[model samples]
Target: MTSSIHNEVIIFSQAAGDTIHILDLYEKNRKNTKFSIYVIKNKNIYDYFNELDLRLKNLVFIPYPKRFGLYNIQLLRKEKKRINSLFKKHFINSVNHKIYFFAHVYDYLTMSFVLSLSKNNTVIFVDYDKYDTNKTLPKQFYHVKDKMLLTIYKYLVGKQLVLTEKKAIKLLFENTNIKSNKTDEVSSKIKEKYSHNIANQSTGNSVLIFETPTAEASIINYKNTMIEILNILVKAGYKIYIKPHPYKGFSPFLRNYNVSICNANVPGELINTSGFNFIFGINSLSICRLAIDRYGSIYSLIQLFTFRRLNEKDYNIKYLLGQSNEKILFINSLNHLDKILAKR
Candidate 1:
């Protein structure tokens, strides 16, 4: 270390809401005199992180227009040259023994530029490519493509960090064809378990965080389903709190229901502090895993919302995901929930 005065950590994403939580964590860490951080932003998603109280000696925000015009395949050669130039000017300067780049997802563009600037020193790669709810044809293509890109990513990046999920790990292996028996499963479990405990300790009627249908661009038949479930929970005489997906925007469907819709950003601390039982959407199994000790997967509920069939492979996936056979709850609708609950 050459008494380096500046250290930079660039986070690449347009979705500031999720990444801000990571930045908040970095801000709270113990500070040393050796390194300072410059929080780089692309697409101008800097406002969310700016609001946080950070003790870092310096923070630099860089925002640029995403290469919207270059989405066409025919323009990639020209686009590649232009992108290279921009990366050299803006992103390359941040690479040093004192500097690091935290690529949020398997963004090929960001990763490519980082590799070009990479030397023998410090470059920390953080991969946070969680599942997306959008089930569109175009997005599906991108998802498969991203898998291949991420595999290549594991080799080039100085460090590969992933969330503790078996499906994600399997996907990475399938995409990258890289067999590493050394793959580390870093758990965000502390946060999740702490929140679970908080929810249990709280005194009040339980809150039910609903995964809205229109997450990403796909629509699930949620209106009727949520209504059906709420009626049962209401009849059970439990007060309900409802929280929607952040990107799904405000839900009008919840207005007529007996549930209270929470519109603000409810942090993990609050989720831990507040008592709530999760009523899952078809795709909300992941979030519910963070809440309770166990989860009941309604395979029939999946059939109710999705036209796609849930086969043995789907159950195998769920089983591989740490859920036992008994934990899987296959029900047609809320009406069937009463019979299931009675048996429980």
Candidate 2:
């Protein structure tokens, strides 16, 4: 069958970050290659994938069941064969298959197992969407349980935890690194969709808010917590705007408050972040890069919440991610935000 010189099969789940960056890489570096994207556990966000750049035609979804533990190499082989079958379904006839992943902790597990199937094939890792934390698998998962899980995943996969390049020695121990900083393509598209001028959006004191529903299990007083932020902003006489996560529906609030919802596709980074005094989120990692870029201070309330439903390891991961990056400030309470804002 006639095809591009190289055939790449990218294993990614989320449409927003990693997948978008992969498209950006393909757009910038037009290597003569045909490719397909394999999504893991994509049932919920299947609709969200459509919003990605229209270049990729074939998107295959492979759900990871909880029963198949991390150490199951045989199960992984079975999954890869299913993926091969998926390739057949798509009639993707190219032996030159190089699997690509963004190399976050969990998705790395999926991509590594897939890479193991083709032992000789090259596996590429990108750090497009992951938060630039000093933390990674080894550092984050130093505890016995997580360490054992990561170890088992590596052992079963058999492929080395190769990061981006020679300069990214730190990421060798970590999971991801700064590879391609091409969030522009996706950001531009989002901006075009929104088309709201930054000046128009922010007339006076305003702050952008992000609500991560995925992390709500760990968040103790979800509604009250959101209300608390809104209340604080209201008392400070700040006009509040919320950009609800695509997965997490907007939190319900009485229309009496000045708080409003943003339906635009604009990412926090794309927005004129300088216009706002502060940016707030509940464990939403997407805005870290933007927070770093803009002169304004960014804060997170992840540590303020309780995680009764979530495991201790998972809860700790969220806590660490808050203080992990210098760009974002992790506050345990709304009261703490006053001092930081005072400095600003």
Candidate 3:
């Protein structure tokens, strides 16, 4: 830990969902401790900040860099002082409090760039989803510029901490040690925000399928497979809800289905799912986040064979920890899924 540190925690967030996920854990821990929290807010999520709780909204200060980049020496020189000041001003007393970054960031190099600026003696990278865990990015970690940055990061920071059971570890290139996953909170707040009336709501037989960018990628036929799954569910009497990835927007293909498309202006993680009996998706990070619950039977559309594009990448690793002990199932085929649904 740093020499002049205090009982404070600073979080550097890239997305609203990741920040919300961190806050869920942080808020639970905050009740029992005297830790001050500040967030390095992502400019993208700032507009929705005011709508959140006043206490949560207050934590979203500590501005992100106006000019970005790690390889750009010009940008680095321009922002170094401001970056250092942001930390010194807010997190001077912050010592062993590890910075929490979602491990599933697309640009691992960019994440490393952020870490290079304010290295905690221990960086706690929280687990999120990645379609291709085995897909290695182009080797840019040991470049001359990166090597220079690495030395600075090491001098500023200490070790690394990962907060995933297993699947998320693949997204991390830097060496890290795993920490136990322990976070549980209710979703009445989410239901209130979304204005979902439980008394008027139907029986808990709804299903939410997250529409991801990778779902419609050229390498796969995820859309068609999902359509078939939805058809099966519709026939089996499951009220379906389709939630598209915010950045990807709506998909025209899903318009043909008998599902309600959520006009969600907020992060998908904040949507109430406890009212639903089953929540399912194809190894999506959002599903992974929501799957840690008792209200819904979480499922991964994990294939048992090389029949789908999901076979081309890493599917679900919940079995590694013990097959579905957490009530999170990984079904192999449509038939397997149907049988399970029939029993339910």
Using lDDT as the measure, which candidate wins? Answer: 2
Per-residue CA lDDT of model 2 for 35-82, tens digit only, reads 566666645344445554445646666666556644677876665566
Ranking by TM-score: 2, 3, 1
**Compared with the true structure, what per-residue lDDT tens digits does model 3 show for residues 203-234?**
65777766665556633565667777888888
Please list all clashing residue pairs in model 2, or write none if there are none. Answer: none
Task: Give the C-alpha lDDT of model 1.
Answer: 0.43
Q: Candidates 1 and 2: which is better by lDDT? A: 2
Residues 163-271 of candidate 1 have per-residue lDDT tens digits of 2222122122223212223112224553453232322233544545545545323334556655776677667655676555543434676777766665333432224
In model 1, the clashing pairs are 151-176, 195-272, 207-276
lDDT of 3: 0.52
In order, what lDDT does every prediction score? 0.43, 0.54, 0.52
Best by TM-score: 2
TM-scores, in order shown? Answer: 0.55, 0.60, 0.58
RMSD of each: 8.3, 7.4, 7.2
- Name the better of 1 and 2 by TM-score: 2
